[model samples]
Target: MEVAEVQKQYIRELLIKGRKIEAIKYLRTNFDLTLRDAKRLAELIDEDIADDEYIKRPGPFSGGGVAILTIVFGLVGVIMLGVAIHLYTSNRSFVREAEQTVAIVVSNPSQPVFEYEINGQTYTYYSNVESDPPSYSMGEEVPIYVNPSNPNDVLINTFMDRWFLISLLGGMGVIFLGVSMLVFFAARAR
Candidate 1:
C-alpha cells in the first residue's frame, strides 16, 4: 500500500522522538502491512530524517536517568506493598480475636477520649490518631474493638481506622510500580 503524506509525516515524527517501535506498529495497524514490511518502512523513514538539521533526535541514553530513578521508586513501592501486607495480616488476626463494644466520646481535645463499661466497671480510652476536623465529637457514640483479656488494648471499629494506612500504602505502591514500567518502556524506545 502507498503510504499517505500525513501518515509519512507522523511516522517521521515518531522516529525523531525515538519511537521507532511505535512507528512500526502504527504502520502495521493503519496500513495493514506485514511486520517485516512495517519495520523496513519505519527504518527507511528514520534514515530519511537522520540528517535533517531542524529535527533533533533523542540520544541513545536520553531517558536512562529517568528510567533508573523510576526503578528506585518501584523498589520502594515493593517495600511499601510488603509492609502493607504484613500490617493487613496482623490486623486481621487482631480483629478476629477482638470483642466489640459501644464507647462514648467523653472529651475532644486534640484526640478524642472514649469511655466504656465492661463487667459493670467503667474504663477510659484515648485515641492515638488525630485528624484536622476530628474524627469524633464530644458526646458522640462509636463502636470499638477491644481485647477481652486486656480492656486497655483497644481500636476504633470503623473501616478507615482499621485499613486506611494499608490502603494508602498499597495505592502508592501500585502507582509507583506503574510509573516505573511506563518510564522503563519510554527509555527503551530511545
Candidate 2:
C-alpha cells in the first residue's frame, strides 16, 4: 500500500482506541503530517464510526414505539395484580385494623419484601411468590379494608390501582397488533 494510506489507517485506529499520544508519535515519525492533521483525522474517523452505528440502530419512531410498548405492558401486569389484590381484599378482607395505635402490615400486594413497619408494630409480608424489592422506593399508600365484624382480622388491602396494570397490558396489545398489522399490510402490498 501507499505510505500515506498506511499512516492514515494507523492514525484512525489509534484515535478510535483513544491513544492520542501513540497516534501523534507515529504521525510525527512516519509522516510529515502536522499535529493538527493527526487530531483532525482521528476526529473524522471517530465521527464516521459514530454516524454509521447510529444509522444501523433503530430510528426514533420504531424504537420509541417499542419502548412505549414495553412500559405499557409492564404497567398492565402491575395494574392487573393490583386489581386482583383489590378484589381479594374487598372480598376476603386481607387488610388488618389494629386496636393498637400502630398496625404494621406488609406494604400490600404492591410490594415484595420481608417486612414493613407502621406505627410501632412490624408486619411480616412477602409477595405471593418469592422476590426482592425493585430497588427503588415506589410504593404508595395502599388502601386497606378492615372487617367490621372482627377487628383482629385485618390484612385486607384492596389493589385499587388496576388501571396501572391495564395500561401495560393494553400497550402490549397495541404494539402487537401494530406489528401484526404492519406485517399483514406489507404482505398484501407485495
Candidate 3:
C-alpha cells in the first residue's frame, strides 16, 4: 500500500519520540503490511529523520534498563505467587478444624460484625474482609466457620470470603510473569 503524506508525517513524529514499535504497529494496522515490511518502513522513517536535532534518541543503556525492569517484575511475580500459596494452605488448615454456624450481621455495612452463639455464650467479632455496597445487610444471617477453641476466629463460608485474596494475587502474578516472559523473548529475538 502507498503511504499517505499524513501517515508518513505521523510515522516521523513517532520515530522522533522514540516510539518505533508504535509506528510499526500503526503501519501494520493502517497499511495492511506484514511485520517485516512495517518494521522496514519504520526504520526507513527513522533514518530519514536521523539528522533532525529535535529527535530525542535513546541512550546506550535503554535496552539494559528494560531488562532490569523486566527482572524486577519477574521477582515480584514470584513473591506474590509464594504469598498466595501460603495463604491458601493456611486457610485450608483453618477450615479443616473450624465448626460451622449461622451468624447475624450486627455492625454497619462497610465493616460487618458477626454475632453468633456457642452453648449459652454470645460472641461478636469484626469480619476480616470488608466491602463497599456491603456484602451483607444488618441483621442478615450468614453461614460461617468458627474455631471451636477461639470463637473470635471466623471465616465466612463463601468462596469469595476465603479465596478472593489468593485468586487476586495468583492472577496478578501470572499476568506479570507472562508479560515478563513475552518481553524477554521479544528482546532476545531482536
Candidate 4:
C-alpha cells in the first residue's frame, strides 16, 4: 500500500511530539514504510525541512559551452564599453577646444549635416533623426556627434549590422555541433 500525504503528515506530527519510536512503528504497520524511510522522514520533519528535490544530471551538451562563450563576449563588450567611456571623459576638454566643422547633408539636401573634426578624423552625426537621415545637400551642416576621447569612434551611417549578430550565433552553433560530434565519436571509440 502507498502512503498518503495526510498519513505522512500525521506520522510527522507524532515524530515531532517526541513519540518518534511510536511513530515509526505506526508508519511501518499502517503506511508500510520501511524503518529507514520512516526514520529519515522523521529526521527531516524534526529539522523543519519540507522535502528534497533531486536534480537531474546534465550530459556534455546541456549546451553550457555556448553559454560560456557568450559570457566571454559579454565580458569583452563590457571592457570595450569601459574604454569608450574613459576616452569620452578624458577627451572632453580636447573636444571642447577643437574647432567644430559642419558638413552639409548631401543626401537629405535640406537638413543640416554637422561634422566635427577631432584627432585629424572627421566625425558626423545627423540632427534629431540619427537613425534615419532625411533627404537634403553635400555641404549642409545638420549636427555632428563625437566621442570625447577618441573622435575615430563614430557612426558613419544609420544602417544596422545585423549580419554580425547572425554570424556570431551561427559560429557558436557550429562549434557546439562540432564538439558534440567529437564527444559522440569519442564515446563510441571507448
- Model 4 lDDT tens row, 98-118: 444444464443344456666
Candidates 2 and 3 compared by TM-score, better number: 3
Instruction: List per-prediction Cα lDDT, in the order shown.
Output: 0.83, 0.49, 0.85, 0.53
Per-residue lDDT of model 1, residues 1-190, tens digit only: 7888998999888887767789999999998999999999888877787565335555534547775687698898898888889989988888799888899999974588999987777899988888778877888889988888898888888877888999999889888888877777777764
Which stretch of 10 consecutive residues in model 1 shows the poorest summed lDDT? 52-61
Ranking by lDDT: 3, 1, 4, 2
**Residue pairs in candidate 1 whose N, alpha carbon or C atoms collide under 3 angstroms:** none
User: Residue 183 in candidate 4 has what lDDT?
Assistant: 56
The prediction achieving the highest lDDT against the true structure is 3
TM-scores, one per candidate: 0.64, 0.26, 0.64, 0.29
lDDT (Cα, 0-100) at 132 in candidate 1: 78
Error of model 1, residue 81, in angstroms: 1.3
List per-candidate RMSD values in Å.
8.0, 15.7, 9.8, 14.0
lDDT of 4: 0.53
lDDT of 1: 0.83
Backbone N/Cα/C clashes per model: 0, 16, 0, 19
What's model 1's TM-score? Answer: 0.64
